[model samples]
Target chain A: MTASLIRILPDLARYAAKALTEKKLRSLLTIVGIAIGPMALTAILGVVQGYSNYVINQLEGLGQNLIILVPSANYDMSSSDIAFLRDLPGVKEVTPFYSLRAKAKQGVRDIDIAIYAVDLDVFFHALGKLRLEEGSLPPPGDTASAVIGHYIAFDETGTRYYRVGDVLTLTYYSFKRGRLIQHSISVIVAGVLAEFGNAFFVNPDVTVFLPLDAGPKLLGMKKWSGIIVVADSPAYVENLTKFLREVYGERANVISLIEISKVVASITAAMRFITIAAGSAAFAVAATGIAATMITSVMERTREIGVLKAIGFTDAEIVTSIILEAILMSLLGSAFGIAAGVAAAYALSTRGMVLQGMQVVIRAPPEITLPMIVKTIALTIVIGVLGSLLPAHRAARIPPAEALRYE
Target chain B: MTRDYRAVDGAESTLGQSPGQVPILELRDVHKVYKVGEVKVHALRGLSVRIMPGDFVAVMGPSGSGKSTFLNIAGLLDVPTRGKVFLLGRDVSRLNEVARARIRNRVIGFVFQQFNLIPRLTIYENIEMPLIPRGLPRRERKKLVLKALREAEGDTSWLPKKPLQLSGGQQQRVAIARAIVGRPRLILADEPTGALDRATAARIAALFIRLNREEKLTIVVVTHDPELAHCARKILMIRDGRIVGAEAPQPQRCIAYSRR
Candidate 1:
């Protein structure tokens, strides 16, 4: 039985090809309709995967053993709080940084930038090495010196606004003596960091770094905004985080990079579900189109089916031939869809999009895995087979005598 | 010759019987009734016929006289509403659809007025259709197709051409070739020459005569043309689903008819 079935495969294939080619316009339209669903699905999945990878990489770049502590409402981190964190078990280094949102002006251009004042040695140790494009780090005890991000030193068109040895003025806001006050100061740019395109949540590209002691005096504030804590090893991060949470209780929000990674993973999974659901809806529409096309084909080929049955073809053979035709169309459409989808994905990953006049670059390229290819092909086959079944059965049920008489 | 080819029910002797002097087809008390919406139409009432091997029979009737219905029953394409149909010594009136299809594929071949060639396939592939269901290998199928094409006097060059590319006569010839490719013992043609010009119709009639005489093939044709019916050895006139007359034309008339 197997051998007999194998013997008929080539003939079945030939018949399927002939049938599809006979109505070129109709077949092409059906294929394109089916392809749209998979194409859209693949493109969306590629973009989402690329973005997820980028976020994961950013999280990894901030050391896995690193944790951050932010003060809750109506609370602030003082020197004593910093000292308590420093003496905690498994703590390698604790760097408390003061962050203030400030508006800075260089020449005639003005932009909003985050100013972070940290102990240079501990900050560099907690985060990895910072890539500098020009000049050296600020000298020790140089309260007037500041290191600016790559975007801060240059305008959007790459024109230099402030370089090494240039002075920039920053305006800081504070509440002093129960009254709103504004202070302005000029600081020399000691160095410019290389461009890091949109990886970290708080992008260092658009921020200025100042000496640790200068923050309280310059901002006229005695409390720290946040503190960065590094565990001795990655294995100690969970324990250290728990200890910090217990000690601070409701006063502070202690978050580890690992916890952020878990949250990011869940967000990506939710996005994937939405994308698949959208793809399924499109697939359903495409399947209906396929069924409609097949029904029309069966109707048009009624006489031909009669001829086949009159000659020697059994009802099963007739059904098999029709189903094979649909399978062939689906396979062709899926091949085209996969190719177009992958191309779209590659283009999206390589060339970033501009949203509201800001350029967003994807740091990771989209990957097409074997499992993805298998899944797409499997989906195509299922749609093809299911869509053609009813029409095939209809063709099989056509009476040879009546079909022969059909005009 | 009078012979009883009917096998006892549930007997193994029903299968693989040698092709002896048994009649090729026999319909005993056949009836066909069609239900059209709320009305019942009696297409055939108590029709009975016997066709011996090597016999060329033509059935003639007006439209709606059930000539086509009778041919369909004989060809195993449809079953009688009530009766016994015996093909090659086996009673097959109550066979299931798949069993009937198997019998049709193995023992019978049919030709239609429209030629019924699959438009998409080339002449060679159209002829190869019957052999495919039998699981014949490609080389063997090609051999049989070539043989049938030569027997039908079809043009070998037309093998690569599609059905629509051929003339009406050539397409009919190809259809004949397809029917004979499986080497069935019986051929049932319904209005085989109805769509052809006079000359083409005469040519097809001569081809049928030649196949019946040279190969000893049993042929049953239904047609309205008396000239075509004259080519057959016996003519059966049907009206209102009943066989009203059966006659044999003079042998001299058959020869003279072919000469024309």
Candidate 2:
């Protein structure tokens, strides 16, 4: 066994080396077709993984035990909605949010912004860690006080737009008037929210705050977009979810942090299948290239096969040597291909793209970890072995005398 | 060395009723036929011959006259349809394909008209080819190959070269080295000098005679050149599938006549 193994090893090495190094262009072309699948797959997966991580981080940053609630358009809510939700058992705090697409004008530049109408008193109560990097919060009963996102602040003026007392203008559409209502209310740009660097585009500072009762009157708001509820403890997260479900049934799109994360996971699973299909196609093409090369190699080495057989190489050894050559070529190609892919992915990921509305460099998640690399290698190995099967069998079946006679 | 020699002798003794006078290879009424669709072709017909140890015999015949076919059967490259072939004492006709291959690798070596030296292999690797099937250790196989090269080419220093690098004469010598590397009982050369120039052919013929006399290696060569055929102590001439004539068994007479 040892003798047979030793005899065939050098031939395998020679064949593989000749394939990879001597015939470099052909080898590269073969590798290109193979590399496409994994490259696209790993990159897309990296982005998806990064995006999911960003969303979870954003949610987790909001606070641990928070459940978001949305009102169904079919089911109108009474003015006692806040009190009804607060009165529920284990309820800690409830903050209603009203958001609409509104235009913001500073001097001459008008930018379309998402206007978030929040109850400043209970809003900060739920989001205590909300940082005001430039300006301060407006006082109570002040309808004219507002804070805009950092992007608006920067775009309006060169930089440093929000100070302690800079008033900002917001244009709203009043349904009663049935026309565009430009509200030139002298509101201080209370604070400028710092940029949370990511691909996502939600800016809370481009927000106008009002007293709870005055919210609908000033913003002409009818239905709330969603409500943010904080749980007293982490343990009440599930109970709060159930409680909200009981109250809303299917009417409200009541969701907790965990539920949102699960939705992202489903999206991730779907992405996985798409990338796998794409990668599998690329791998098949690469495998076909490998098979063609192996068959051609077998034809070229007919006389060598005969000689090896005449020397004492069994049929099994001859086949194994050829297969070994193919496998070695594939593995080496995969290593180079994957390395090139990873480098490309890293470079592309650092560029601007929407990941959870933050302007941040979203690096691929750790899930594209060691197992993924190992799996790529294993895939290449399978491709190699399967690709060489026909050629190896052909080589093994050659008659020793006939092969020896081959010119 | 003596053990291997005795093994060959012991095997030869079991061949037929003749206890000690066993030829290295004995073809007893061998017949080979081929069929293509319904058309049958007889390649050999009741051919019988005995090649004794240390005998340099040449089989001469025209193309398609069964000389190559006879050589193929004698070399164990192909089996006869009928009758028995005895390598030493073993009836190869009864042996399975694998067993026959084993005997061929161990007991017989072949040189071909084409030189059939594996092109990709170096001279040394080419010579070592026959021993690979014997499951010999790489170290021992290397030693035998080096020994064969030394004996055949006398450390010519071109022994490491490939067949393409060597002259026709040199390549034939390498083929001879490969054939005798395993020190088989019988060496069969099928028109071994057919592709060479006159001088190169003469050199190969002389090499065969030297190997036969010095190492006592029985050599069978097939050729159409009468001069080359005349160099052998025993010459068998085939016209159809059967041996029609053979030179008399008188080595001394030929030497005496040549000297006079």
Candidate 3:
């Protein structure tokens, strides 16, 4: 039986092709019904997964082995605390910094930007992905120097707003002697960093960098608010984070970039589950359409089946022919569905995600992995097989004598 | 010789029962009961008949006289309620449906009143239908299809066209080609010309006579046309589910008439 089935597979396919082509409109409609499920699943998953991957890659770029230590309420970190962190085992470098939510003005155009007063050279090494677009990082102990972010040098529309030699005015409010006084300062733009997209801790596209000593003189920052610690490699990041948590206790929050990326991956997985569940609903409807169409085909071809049986076709052969038709339809449907899905994914990716104070880089084209396509095709085949079960069974059980008499 | 070969029910008439040779087909007291929605219909009473290996026999009866039922049983398309059916000395009555289907395909061929060609398939594919169930190789099936078409007096040019695209006589020829392509020893045709005009029916009848003589096949046809019945080597009159009478016709005329 197995050998004969292999022999008749081509004939069965030919027979099924004729049936599909005979009812062109119904066949096309049924194929479209099947296509909808895969299209929704592939398109949605591509966009979400593409964006999540972009975010994770950017976070890793920010430095996979870097751990950030932030002081909790009513807590402060002095120079001795920074020295203590640098002395810890497996610690590569420790750079304590102060950040002010400042507004920068260039020709009366004011924009919100983070002013980070950290050692520019050490900061660039610890935050690995930032590169200088215009000039070099600030010289050591150069409190009068500043490096503007990409958006500060070029405005939101990408027009040139500030050059490397430009002096920028920064304004921040501080409470002194029970009065809120807005303090203003000027610093020379030593360099302009290139466009770095969203990072979990900071968006480099909308920040200003300065030398470490500038924090104490310009911002009157007596205590370090944040410490960026670099581990020797990503392998040591978790250990360092655990060790730092025990040392800082409730007075500080320790975070590793790798952990943030892991959280992002899990969230993406949950999103995939919801999308597939929704896609399966569409497949259920498509399966119903396929079942109805195949049932009608069997009913319409009653006399033809009778003739086939009279000429010695077996019940199993009849069933195989019907199932073959369904599989053929699904193959045709998936080819088109995958194409449409990838196209939709690319189109949906162009709208960048914007937040209150951070600007994400304009979206890149969506990614479609090989496994995604394999998963889509696998799902379609399942529905095809499931849809044809009852009809094939009915076709097999039909008695030749009665079928021959059908009009 | 006619009286010697005539088989009567329950008479122990040794028709086609030569020494060390069995009949091509034999039925012993076969009964068929049908149910039409709560009504028990006795379509066939206890009927028995036998045919030799190379006989052209015709069973003639009016509508609802059990000729169709006999054809179904003889063709292995349906089972009997009582008694045994033997084909080539094998008891096929007790076989499973799959086994019965295999015998129906390899040992017997059928031609119905309607051509019964699948309209979606080309004529060549229709002719190849019988051999497909046997999983015959493509080259062999093609050779057999062409040869059977020639034997059935069908033109090879019609091979690429659908059954509905041909004339009624041509369609019946294709049907005949399909039935014979498997090289079955027994051929059962039910009202082979019931849908054709008189001229076409004569042509189809002539083709059957030619096939019978040329192929040495055992042919059984159930028909209402006496002209067809007159051409058979042996004629059985069936009524009320039994063989009422049997006789021999002048078979020389069918041969001579086919030559025209």
Candidate 4:
């Protein structure tokens, strides 16, 4: 056995090299299909992962282990409901919110804006995700107070129309209360938000802040859209959700950052399945490429097989040689494919984009796991074996006389 | 005579010495047939022939005359459909494929018409191929390969050159070296000079005759050329899968000459 191995090794190596060199372009093209899927998949998954991560981070940053309770299918808030929720057990904070489509009027200049009202004391503690870039929080008992995002404060002309202590008028319509509902309010824009994107602090891409207690009188609402609940600790998060669900009896929509993140993960997993389902076609094509090459190689070497048999090589040896050749080809090709995929991933990760006014960061690292590497190798081996079957069998079936007869 | 060229019938002369008369190959009514679907083609028809020690024999026939099949059977590369073939007086027909292969590798060397040298291998590696299954140490195999290359008497530099780089005559020499490298008792040449020019053919023929004379080796040459067959001491003519006629170059040389 050792003697046979010693004799066959050098001969097989020479055979493999000669086969590869004989058809350089065809070999290169064959490997291209193999590299595409992993490369595209890595880059796409990286970006999706990065974006999802950023959103989750922002949500968790609002408050740790916190829950937000809202109406089952509503999008508004009222002061009366806020007062009622404020007295509920396990509710650490309650704040009413009123947001309306309004236009800021500043001495013959107008900009679209969202007029948001809140209570000064409760807003300061319960404004979970309202971050300010360049302004202070509303003071205690400050009825005419407001703050804005960074982008809403500046215009393309570098003009600041609304700022702190600025009294600007806001417009609205009226809704009759049953027989006589009405709505009309022109409130002051006490503070302009900081810059966020391409809008001024008082622009429609902007938001105006007002006193929470004053929202019920202005918007004429009897119920609240949502209520914020801060747990005593992370341990109480599940209990709070259960308590809220039991009380609201399906009328309340409770969403937590953890839940949202889980949703994102499931969605990404589904997307991955779709991507792989689509990419499998490409892989199949690559496998076929390998099969075709192996078949051609077998046809070309029919005489060689005869010679080996004539020289005392068994049927097993002929089959093994062909299979070994296929495996070597796949291994070489897959290696180059993986390297190309990684290089492509890295190149696409940078150059972040904007989505929904949030920065979309792409994270394309090699980020390859051990299982993925193993899977790639295993897949290549399978393909190699499958590819060599026709060739190996053909070589094995050649009658010694007929094969030797081939020139 | 430099060496005794008598035949060895070891069964009669059991002196524990070769007696210089070893019947290296013996066939008793060997029959080989090939079946293609329902048609059975008889390639060898109850052929019985013996190759004695130190005898240079030639098998000449037309195409499809089954001479190649006879050679294959004699070399143990292929088995007969019926009949017993003995190598060194051991019945090889009963042996398995692997056992027969071992015998083929060790007891017999083959020289093909096309010079079947692997194009990628150098002359030295080509010669070394037959020695690989010998289970010999590397140093020993190397020594044998070099010695065979030296015996070929071609350019030693060609040892490192591939077959294509060498001429027809040189390639034939390499093939000869490869065949004789393992020092097999019997050498089978299947149209060894069919591809070479007349002059190169004569040289190869001279080499074979010299090997048989000097080493007392048994040789069987199969060819279609009548002139080539003339050089052998015994010429067997085959037609339609049977030995039609046989001639001994010197019948006057009696059985005494064959004995000693």
State the DockQ of every prediction: 0.57, 0.20, 0.57, 0.23
Interface RMSD of each: 1.4, 4.3, 1.3, 3.2
Worst 10 residues of 2 chain B by lDDT: B1-10
Q: Best by TM-score, which number? A: 3
Candidate 4, residue B106: CA error in Å?
4.1
Give the per-residue lDDT of model 1 (tens digit) for A6-119. Answer: 678778878888999999999999999888777877777877777777777777776788888999877878878778888888988888888888888856767888888888
Candidate 3, A1-407: lDDT as tens digits: 76787788898898899889989999999999999988898789988888788878988998888889999978988778888988988888889888888898756788888888887777788776888999888787789889989988887678888898889888999888999999999999999999886565677887889888899987897877799888888999988888889988999999988988989899989998999899999999989989999999999888888777777777888888999999999888887888899888888887754544455453756778899899889889889879999989888887787787788
Off by over 4 Å in 1: A1-3, A87-91, A101-113, A129-195, A217-221, A232-250, A346-364, B1-20, B239-245, B251-259
What would the per-residue lDDT of candidate 1 be over residues B1-260, giving only the tens digit for each residue? 12122321111121223444677788887899999999988888878787777778888889999998999888877788998899987999998877787788888888889898888788998999988878877899999999999989898999999999999999999999988999999999988898998888878988998999898788889998777887887777788987766666455545226555
Put the candidates in DockQ order, highest first.
Answer: 3, 1, 4, 2
What TM-score results for chain B in every one of the models?
0.90, 0.85, 0.92, 0.87
lDDT tens digits by residue: candidate 2, A56-117: 67655556677878878787665577788888777788877777666777557676666666
TM-score (all chains, Cα) for each model = 0.86, 0.77, 0.90, 0.74
Would you give me the overall lDDT of model 4?
0.67
Q: What is the lDDT of candidate 2?
A: 0.70
lDDT (0-100) at residue B132 of candidate 3?
75
Worst 10 residues of 3 chain A by lDDT: A353-362
